[model samples]
Target: MARQCDLTGKARQANHKVSHANNKTRVFKQPNLKTKKVFDPESGQTIRLKLATSTIKTLDKLGLSKFLRKYYK
Candidate 1:
C-alpha cells in the first residue's frame, strides 16, 4: 500500500532541509500515520484503517459515521 492516510489521503510532502551555513538538502516530510482499528457505530464493526494522526483526532471527535458523511461524501 502507498504511504498515505486512507481516510484523509494525507501523504508525504516535498521540502528542503537547511543548515546554518545556508545549505539546503531535498527532503520528504512524511505524515504521522498509524494503523488503527476504529469502531463504526453504524455498522457495529471495527474497521482497520491507515490514518494520519490529525485524522485520528478528528475521528475521535466527530466519530466514524459523521466524519465519513462530512468528508468522504
Candidate 2:
C-alpha cells in the first residue's frame, strides 16, 4: 500500500525515503500573502489590492469597501 499526494496526484509509499528528486516541501510557503492595500507613492490614495491568500470568502466577511479603506490612510 502507498500514500498518494493529493496535490500533485502522485503515489508514494509511507515514509519510504522521499528523495531530492521527488521533493514536495518546496511547493509553497505558509505566509502566502500579498499587500492588502497599496498606497500611492504620490497622493497616497488607496488602491484596491489583490493578495493571493486573501480569498473572496475572507473579504466578504471583512466588508472591505472603498470607504472602509479610508481608515488605513
Candidate 3:
C-alpha cells in the first residue's frame, strides 16, 4: 500500500530544500499518518484505517459516522 491517509487521501508532497549556498535539492514531504481502529456506530463494528493525524483529530471531534458523511459525500 502507498504511504497515504486513507480517509483524506493525503500523500507525499514534492518540495525543495535550500542550502546556505542557494542550492536546492528535491525532497518529498510525507504526511503524518497512523494506523487507527475506529468504531462505526451505524454498523456497530470497528474498522481499521490508515489515517493522517489531522484526520484523526477531526474524527475524534466529529466521530466516524459524521466525519464520513461530511467528507465522503
Candidate 4:
C-alpha cells in the first residue's frame, strides 16, 4: 500500500518483507546423553563433561589444585 499527499504530487511506499531463502531455520533433535560431549561452539573446542559439580567442589577443597589445574584454567 502507498499513501499519497493531497496537496502535492508525492507518495510514500509502505515497507514490506523481502523474499529470501529460509537459511536461518534449523531442525533440532533430542540429545543423546549416553554419548560424551564433543563440541563447544563458543570456543570451537572439543570437550568432555564427565565430572559432577559435587566432585569438582571436593577437588577444589581437598587441595587437588595440581590435578584440576588444567580444567580450572
Candidate 5:
C-alpha cells in the first residue's frame, strides 16, 4: 500500500538533500499517514483508510458522514 492520505489526496514529495559541499541526494518527503478505522454512522460500517494526521483531525471535527459527503464524489 502506498503512503497517502485517502481523504486529502496527499502523497510523497520528491526533493534533494543538500550537503555542505553542495552535493545533492534524492529524497522523498512522505505524508504522515496512518491506517485508521472510521465508522460511518449512516451506514453503520467501519472503513479502514490510510489518512494523514491533519485529515484525521478534520474528520474528528466534521465526523465521518459529513466529511465523506463533502469530500467524496
Candidate 6:
C-alpha cells in the first residue's frame, strides 16, 4: 500500500533542500500515516484504514459515516 491518508488523501510532498552553498537536493515530505481499525457502530463492523492523525481525531469526534459524508462528499 502507498503511504497516504485514506480519508483526506494526503500524500508525500516533493520539495528541495537548499544548502548554504546554494545547492539543492530533492526530498520528499511524507505525511504521518497510521493503519487503524475503525469500528462502525451503525454498521456493526470494523474497517481497517490508513489515516493521518488529524483525520483520526476528526473521525473520533464525528464517527465514520458522518466523517465520510462531511469530507468525501
What's the lDDT for all of these models?
0.93, 0.42, 0.94, 0.40, 0.91, 0.91
What lDDT does model 5 reach? 0.91
Regions more than 4 Å wrong, model 2: 1-17, 20-46, 53-55, 65-73
Cα lDDT tens digits for candidate 4, 1-73: 2233221223433444444863454433322222134344457786654433444444446534443464456
Lowest-sum lDDT 10-residue window in model 3: 38-47
| Tens-digit lDDT track of model 2 for 1-73 | 1233221223323334346797544332233334456455457587655344434344455545542464345
Task: Mark the 10 consecutive residues where model 1 has the least summed lDDT.
Answer: 39-48
Taking all chains together, the TM-score of candidate 4 against the true structure is 0.21
Model 1 residue 4 distance off true place after TM-score fit, in angstroms: 0.6
Model 4 stretches with alpha carbons more than 4 Å out: 1-49, 65-73
Task: Judging by TM-score against the true structure, name the best candidate.
Answer: 3
lDDT of 1 by residue, 1-73 (tens): 9999998889999999999998999999999999999998777899899999999999999988899899977
4 against 5, candidate with superior TM-score: 5
- By summed lDDT, the worst window of 10 consecutive residues in model 4 runs over 1-10
- 1-73, model 3: which lDDT tens digit per residue? 9999998999999999999999999999999999999988778899999999999999999988889899998
Q: Among these predicted structures, which one has the highest lDDT?
A: 3
Model 4, residue 10: distance off in Å is 74
Model 6 Cα lDDT, one tens digit per residue, 1-73: 8999987989999999999999999999999888999998888999899999989999989988998789777
Query: Candidate 6 at 12: error in angstroms?
Result: 0.3
Candidate 5, position 26, lDDT:
100
The better candidate by TM-score, 2 or 4, is 2
Task: Give each model a TM-score.
Answer: 0.87, 0.24, 0.93, 0.21, 0.84, 0.87
